[model samples]
Target: MDTLNSGSGKLVGLSFEMGPIRPPSEGGSYSLLIRVTRNCPWNQCTFCYGRPYDHEKFQMRSVDEVKADIDTAGLLCDEIKNVSWELGYNGDINTQVGTALIRRMPQLGNSHSFINVFNWLHSGARTAFLQDADTPIIPTPRLVEIIRYLREKFPSLERVTSYARAKTIFKKKEEDLKDLSCAGLTRLHIGLETGDDELLWKVKKGVTAEEHIVAGRKVMEAGMELSEYIMPGLGGRAMSRQHAENTARVLNAINPDFIRSRPFTPLPGTPLFDVYMNNELELLSPHECLEEMKILIAGLDVTSRICFDHFRNPSYLNAPGQLVHLLKQDYDGYKLPEEKGSLLEFIEKGLRIGEEKFLKTESYQL
Candidate 1:
């Protein structure tokens, strides 16, 4: 009776809808996403475009709503398995056919939405991400229940993660965080954009540098892997050096499990973009940004792994000549303290290339 086809009255329709965003790491994980909250409660970060948070009012879903999402995701797994069997798939659906099957879903209509489910199953759904930015800000008890219920329904799921605002994570008691971790909240992606208080205020990040350090350390202490996203040129031309140095200082304090390098890409819609347009915020050219990134990498004294995986970051070594195009990663990712010198060398080389690429990029932003 746990099956979708078993008259559960839970999602009579086979189709499923997930929130608009997930961490870049989760994109390839085929992770089941349960949107516990509506939009961001604090969507004021100027560098952020947490869509549809940009246009929608924020709201929290009830416990029942969250549970229903888990149930639906569970049923989806069941239906996908059923469809695979019907198609004579002996526990393995080829990627090519799985892709083609997805393409033909509309022709099959809602009645045959199992094709959609089959696509997921073929890809090996092994993880889950609680979506719609910053779920850790949700009440501790409610979040605990949601995590527990999600694990119960998808017990074999490998890991569960969610974005946590430093302000929210800092406010939660240490004991509550440990409880949440025990309840299966394994990872957290925090946007510690910069360690400069002035930049934090300018971006409206809602947390100071000290709180960011505290919240990040708290996550690690509670047995959660922390991925701190650091923007290289968030301070723009004015505070670029301070941004890099202060960010390095903060990362050294937390020594987070992962330091994600997110080079600044001014969105045309945000206040920062307006600041750039009005010449109030002197934007960092590709060379300056790379130099800033070099300073950041050279200054980092953490044992954390660094990932220059975002497309916005220039991949000096790997991509060869995409320095200004906003199109390549230097490498997959690197474990810091070891690859530190090499990462800096790569960035330094790119800085020497001295090309203004971002200005030439024709709208990579959607």
Candidate 2:
């Protein structure tokens, strides 16, 4: 490991590879991020068009490379704990220890790796997220080795999760999925996007609705929690009803542990943005999006938590002129069947607030 001499003491040169993004829930929990792969394996999907990875080619890091990163992160954690001890915090990582360590090693302030590790340690280091789009796309044995190695390095990790493609999960054998679960992969966040076959084909999602159900059920059977992402307004106005109804139908069949809503916004530079510019597809208005959500929620028969955890989910202005979100926006979200009535009432409240109080989809463009 590299080292830097600071005025107070020696500091390990903490540098490790990290991916562009993880699920918002992972961010909320301050999960330690490990980049097992680089970029996305499948960069299609007109909606995203792989913009997050800058359309870079996907590449798998050798097991040694990933292990080295994990080791570096572990070293950083040890160094931080040492600093805490020297600061009289008795090895407790906290705001004071973090601030003092950064003051002693100013370079840490600019290190994303240090920031991620520090925040994760401060947050209890109970979880981790494997990064880049589809981690399970790696060979089963190698992926298992990585997960086990991660757990071995950080025994405090209680949950490990990753973003996976449904088609990839469907391609895996049941025994392989069980191996992954046994290796400590606790959850998978999949982009079900929409279950309408027409919309799925139009968006080049590369997976069918049946494939989603099969993959979801397989994960559940493997004893791994599954979170399916649904994109409201993905079908636009033309297929809104079908999109909502079919997506709920698919989720109902799978009964995933969590159903996350990611309201669609046509980001510039994506193929869908060009389609929107050409007026080939119409975006849903705020009220229409809420109505579509109402249809989707009413159709859900699952026992999952439905979350609107993303900022892109619909919001409105209250009488006090302050911005307000329609849904709770928590990671756990609202429980279905029990809180279903209350969630529907929230949608109704948003609908009654009228379209004028809400921002247009175009306003969300980046």
Who wins the lDDT comparison? Answer: 2
Report RMSD for candidate 1: 4.4
**Residue pairs with backbone overlap in model 1:** 315-330, 324-357
lDDT per residue, candidate 2, 283-356, as tens digits? 99999999999999999999999999998998888899898988989999998899999999999998888799
Model 1: per-residue lDDT, tens digit, 1-366?
A: 111232222223555456677777776565666789878888788877554466577778888888886776667666455544545565465654344344444443353334434444556666788877878777889999999998887667678999888999999999999999999999999999999888898888889999999999999999999999988777888999999889989999999998887777678677777777787877677778777877888888989888877776664333354334233343237887998777777766666653743332124354
Positional deviation of residue 309's Cα in model 1 after best superposition, in angstroms: 1.6
Query: How far out, in Å, is residue 311 in model 1?
Result: 1.1
Best candidate, TM-score = 2
Estimate every model's Cα lDDT from 0 to 1: 0.74, 0.92
Q: What does the lDDT read for residue 330 in candidate 2?
A: 92
Weakest lDDT window of 10 consecutive positions for candidate 1: 1-10
lDDT of 2 at 97: 82
Q: TM-score for every candidate vs. truth? A: 0.87, 0.97
